[model samples]
Target: MVSGTGPETVPEAEFRSYYGHPVIKRPIWHVPHMPLYLYLGGLSGASSLTAVLAGLTGRHRLARAARITAALGASTGSAFLIAELGRPARFLNMLRVFKPTSPMSVGSWILAAQGGLSAAAAVSDVTGILPAVGDAAALATVVTGPLTATYTAVLVADTAVPAWHAGYRELPFLFAGSALASAGAAGMLATPRAEAGPARAVALLGAAVETAAATLLEQRLGLVGEPYRQGRAGLLLRVARALTAGGGLLTLLAGRSRVATAASGLALTAGALCTRFGVLEAGRASAADPKYTVVPQRERVETAGPASVPGR
Candidate 1:
């Protein structure tokens, strides 16, 4: 209706959404409990693997320590998971049916099997009630251990969470490395210095792998990686990388003294915990921001060309 303008033409907008609402539903998982569960689950899985390796190498004391660590971690982690579920009774229903397509279902079954195996191995080691049975249980963990360590990554990444789903390819590696480092740290802490060589090696290797995977994930993700570099998540990730890198370096020098070894192991464990918390926090942040969801979908649509119809 302007006198100078022939017509009041509205400019076409490139993208549209409903009132800044999130396109994807956010995960309802609570903090501390969920992150703590992830940390313990990784610890349990990695310790199980450490136990198997120790047993094979005739490092009986280390094997015993690993069994104890696995059992304690799984048992404690299950408690956190149940707390997250908001009811202990619901946890029992997880075993009613096995759904391979559902990560939660698969993880439940895996955790159940792991709990039984780790508990048996730990008990036999403690009471000498059934040494043969304990050895068999420990051996069985060789199958479940890797799954236990890596499946949480699958569980988290197989979601609508932008940061988690986008980084699915590298998440497993990150988680597995964290698990191995945790197991190694626990083994080193519990075992005598003379027998902690394998643990030290595992810790260093895991730290290196974890650091590399995290760097690649951040670099390759571009805009999706923003959440990881902003706010509390960024601080946590930065701390995690620093601790992991420093811990790995310190572990190399740990051969000189027991105090140095203990310090390195503690640092590695703390770093792994921080990594878990950071990843979870990043996902939460990504889901909270409408820009993360809307912009990505918009890019995909634009890249798909004229023939690409919406809502396909």
Candidate 2:
């Protein structure tokens, strides 16, 4: 409290935490592994959705490419996740009980189901076996695919990290857009240019959505969003935005050119990866800074008034 002649004349308290330490512990999720998992999980989820849609529309080559991408992404992503857990059993242990209220639990289940279904679809596509079962599996992924793409956003948003928690409204859309862009990139890369028109369209749409969501998140978050606009996180996100924008334009003008398609696909893939890494870095930065945690809380208390404050 400020020393003043009267209460009304006192200045507001400056924000501080004990001994300059962070008010909340920084997330222990390791670099590369966690971000890679996030990217690959989104890729797998969106690829599955693309595969199902392409198949329904008679784009067999595109569908096959998406199926393969979905299977590989899911399997590889799960490996990264298991490695992060330090044990495969730890990954399996999460499936012992279903908890609807737990985003991690729900995400684990979605990942498992998506992985299995995508793998089945890919195998059937490659081997020309179990066509009926493959169709069923591919169709089932429609239910799990969108959930898998966006659930990680929920998982992170549930945490206390100001960057993640405060942007909950926009994070899911951001992740979903990134996921779609990733899958579309994979489809474009794997399928022939002539057969990849829909993939290009998806990539363009995803880029638009991703860019809009990211802009809104930063704008709406105000001070809490500083981490995303400064430091390593800012650099990465800027690169992501540039790459995604360039890739989207390339896809728009690709015009049956294999080189342009490949270039756009590669750019989009890199942008999506950068987005995941940047988001993680922003969350870490926010968690490490005391101001991000304290300012909003103080503002909330002040807005609610002394009568509503706890322990008053």
Candidate 3:
């Protein structure tokens, strides 16, 4: 309200949806190529957990490498995301006001803490390379690994995107599972046969979670889930399912041979990437259609509308 300006007068009334176009604002470039960050961060965190498990079980070399790589990846991926945000400085605004309802805010804090802990843990391992710091880093990862593996689904679910918003109940489970699988993959590659037991467990659990989530997402979404079941989204889903399954199977046999471990690691990594990309694509497609938007709103209105009177 400017003091010199005349009383603010309302203009002609118009009823229009925001960004009325069903399509999103950007071209294919807007596509989330870096959705790998989510995958990487989760994988990194899970790998750290695997490292911890391996360490507890007396797998020193495997645990050290896993912890180091996981922390590095988490740190790198987090940096990429912060750089990508429109207002990186506003990132701190995330902490200014806490809102569990906002996944972005929650994820920001999670990532921040994860980065510090992962770095500390990974760096601490350099006792051979930097003995003093290695000790402290290992201890810090104990707190960060689990949060890193789990918070990404919350980030996706907090959005207004139809696909993500509706699938809130299952996305965290899906992401966590995927993270576990990914971590297992890396562990299989880096760990000795005797030490990779926990990696196998994580992979199996991850595959189970991913498969269950995919089944539920496809079944429960009705029409809105179409994006995931068709087109590029469909392709991505297929690859994710296949890779996750293959990876899990490979993990089971990881103790037998190095080839299986390598295959499992690669497959799990591929599956994680496919899942992340597919999710982003599905959200884009869901937002791109007027029918999906209009029909749902109309259905809601009709169901809630006032009843008509026969006489009136």
Against the reference, the lDDT scores of all candidates come to 0.89, 0.93, 0.76
**Candidate 3: what lDDT?**
0.76
Clashes (backbone N, CA, C under 3 Å), per candidate, total 0, 0, 4
Displacement of the residue 157 alpha carbon in candidate 1, Å? 0.9
What TM-scores do the predictions have? 0.92, 0.94, 0.82
If the candidates were sorted by their lDDT against the true structure, best first, what order would they fall in? 2, 1, 3
Candidate 3 lDDT for residue 146: 74
Could you report the Cα RMSD, in angstroms, for every candidate shown? Answer: 3.4, 3.4, 10.3
Candidate 2 per-residue C-alpha lDDT over 1-312 given as tens digits, one digit per residue, 9 for 90 to 100: 445664556577765678978899999999899999999999999999899888878899999999999999999999999999999999999999989999999999999999999999999999999999998999999998898899999999999999999999999999999999999999999988877877877888889999999999999999999999999999999999999999999998888788988999999999999999999999999999899999999899999886855786
Of the candidates shown, which would achieve the greatest TM-score relative to the real structure? Answer: 2
TM-score-superior candidate, 2 or 3: 2
Residue ranges of candidate 2 with Cα displaced over 4 Å: 1-15, 308-312
Tell how far residue 82 is off in model 2, in angstroms: 0.4
Off by over 4 Å in 3: 1-20, 23-29, 86-101, 128-143, 304-312
Candidate 1 local lDDT, residue 58: 84
